[model samples]
Target: MKHITILVPDGQTSLSSVACIVGSYEMFTRANGYWSQTEAGKKNGTKELYKIELAGVSKKAEFDNGLLTVTTHVHISNISKTNLIIIPSLVRDYETAVKGNKLLIEWIEQQYKAGAEIASMCTGTFMLASAGLLDGKNCSTHWSAADTFRTLFPNVNLLADQLITDEHGIYTNGGAYSFLNLLLYLVEKYYDRQTAIFCSKIFQIEMDRQSQSAFTIFTGQKSHGDEMVKEAQAYIENNLQEKISVEQLSSIFSVGRRNFDRRFIKATGNTPVEYSQRVKIESAKKAFETSRKTINEVMYEVGYNDVKAFREVFRKITGMSPLEYRNRYNKEAVV
Candidate 1:
């Protein structure tokens, strides 16, 4: 049987806040029972697909002046190992979560070295990233936390628009409650697609939600201490309807071509050209959401007259064609 250890971090706890632990427990337990009764398991003799347990560094995780407590089954030292380690979303301050779960992080690294797959849900990606597992891998965190996550872990590829990321047996899901989609993906990968579909219907959760881009509110990456990049970002946002080129931007910013590109990328995690496209697409997204503009009008308004080029960039950034985006998100279109 596959050993699945859900590590409950030593952080604040309340019935209202412990969604990760409870949600994962319910999914796996219910999934195991589903497998047992389905024809999909007829090929295998054993019915139980996973041996799930909640392990933690502390005996009892209490918070709010001991008003709440989360009981753990096994201590970090008790378990020799397991097949999978799932890090749930940390509800408390991320730094606090990391500091309190230092032992759990070490254990997770040990388990990975011992051939176990690690999956982090939402902000739980922070813990896995802390372990240096995501240093050179593609990972996703909640969009709201993307800026902070990128600031802290620059080496990790923070795909803020992706709902799930799976690289080298290390998996991570986008921020917030999107962990349900990640769980469904895991169920399909570990068990079967039919089972995953069954669980989706049972839980009333949308299946195959591959991108969080539509929900992401782009406020521009300006937290870095680079004033020039901030100015460049502002210029791009202001001139979305104007034709702006890298050469002109660098010259206007009074920086050398090579240095401007490097500084902009390092500061904002996007190259000058990529940043411009994102700014334009963001403007276009707003137009799609609130305006009844035709695709052509929106395209031309965003300074893109080439049908193919605009469609391609729109799809690349938002993961949906312009028309599809308008149809789904436009309140005016719905009316």
Candidate 2:
């Protein structure tokens, strides 16, 4: 049987993090039972596919101010080898979580060097990134945490709009609850499409959700300590219905155009034009979600008069057409 170790980090973690541990254990256990009844199981006499274990630096980890405690089956030092390791989401204060879990981080690196695949769920990506495993790799974390993650891990490519990122045997997913989607993807990879679909149906998880873009709420990054950039961000947000230009912003902010562009990108991780587009699209998304406005109505409200331009940009940022987004999010919208 393939060995699967779920790393239980020490800290005040999100409830979802603990859920990932319990959920993963249940998933593989059920997968093993289901596989045993298949024709292939009878042919090869294969029963259990994966032996799952929860491991921590210590025997147990407490969370939520000691309201909850997770007991681990094995210590990190004891598990010298494993096929896969699942890292749960970190606490809100990620820097402290990283600092506190140094042992877990080191163990993760050792395991990866020994040829074990690593998968981090939600903010668990922080642990892998802290271990220097994601320096040049693409990663995904919760959309709300994207700004903070980028500030901390500038070398790693953070695809906040992605639901899952898989490269070099390191897998990551966005959002706290989206780990279910990642679990399903793993099932499809290690088992088969049939088994993955079966698990999805059993868990009531929507299958083939490739992007978390539709769920992201773009709150412009303003903590970079650039007063001019903060003013520019406020301007872009306030003027969503107007056509804002980089040159115009530069002139208004009394900075050179090129210098302004550099400062804006450094502060917000987006060019002035891209920032404007995101702000406009975010406003348009809100209108679609809460109001019975037509696509064109919302587009024009967000300063986009051209139908093709609006549709393309909306789809690019949100991974969905305007009507589709409305139908999915707006309960009153007719499908």
Candidate 3:
């Protein structure tokens, strides 16, 4: 049987972490049980496909200052091996979360080195990334935590736009609550597409949501400790309707053009140009949400005169055309 281990982390974890573990366990165990009860499942031997359990640093995981405790099936130091390790979204104070679970982190590394696949949910990617498992690998985390994640793990190809990423034996999902997508993906991979669909209906998770871009709210990084880059972000936000230029920003901030671009990227995980585009697109998003203006009008309001350029940029950032975005989100849109 394929063993699935859900790593229960300590610190101020979200209830979704428990929810994630239960959901995964339920789906896998239910699938096996359901199929076993059926003649086809019995004949095919699909019922004994997976075994699920929770593993942690200790037998009892205390959270919220001992208010809640999750008893584990196995302790990390005791378990020799498992087929898969699922890292649930730990607490948001990622640094403390990592520090508190040093042994669990080490155990995860050992498991990965022992030929087990590692999957991280939301902020759990922080732990995997902390263990250097995600270095040079494409991964994702919750869009809200994108800035912090990028700042901490620069080597990780943090694809914040994707809902899920699978590289080598590691899997990552974009957000904690949206983890159902990744779960379904895993279910489909281990079982079958048909089983995944059936499970989705049972769990009420939407299938085939490939991008987190549409739901993402673009908030520029301002906590990178660069005052000049902060000023540049403020300028871009303030002057979206104006023709904002890199040279202008660099000169305004008393930095050289190439050097300014580099600094801005380092400070915000986005080049000056990319940052400006994000600012403009975010402004356009607000317009679509609050105004009855046409797409072209909204584009122009955001200082883009060329229709094609505006549409392309809008689609790139939002994962939908201007019209589609407006139709979906704008309450004022006409029939």
Whose lDDT is greatest here? 2
Question: What are the per-residue Cα lDDT tens digits for candidate 2 across 258-329?
Answer: 999999999999999989999999999999889998998999899999999999999999998998899989
Pairs of colliding residues, candidate 3:
none
lDDT to native, each model: 0.85, 0.89, 0.85
Higher-lDDT candidate of 2 and 3? 2
Put down candidate 3 lDDT per residue, 1-335, tens digits, no spaces: 67888888765576767777777777777666655655656677665777788888777776666766788898777778798888888878888888988888998998999999988998889999999998899999999989888888889899999999999999999886788899889888876777788888888889988998988888888888888888889988988898888988988988999999998888888888888888899989888888888988888888899999999998999899989998899767855
RMSD of each: 2.4, 1.5, 2.1
Quality of model 3 by C-alpha lDDT: 0.85
Ranked by TM-score, the better of candidates 2 and 3 is 2
**The best candidate in terms of TM-score:** 2
In candidate 2, what residue range of length 10 has the lowest lDDT sum?
40-49
The true-structure Cα RMSD of candidate 2 reads 1.5
* TM accuracy, model 3: 0.92
Looking at model 1, which ten-residue stretch has the lowest summed lDDT? Answer: 11-20
Q: What are the runs in model 2 whose C-alpha is more than 4 Å off?
A: none
Encode model 1's per-residue lDDT on 1-335: one tens digit a residue.
77888887777333323677778888888888888777867657677988889898788887556776778888878889798888888754677767877888899999999999988988888899989999988999888888889998889988889999989999898867888898899888877888889899999899999998877877778899999999989888888788898999999989999999999999988898988898888889999999888889999998998999999999998888999999999877767
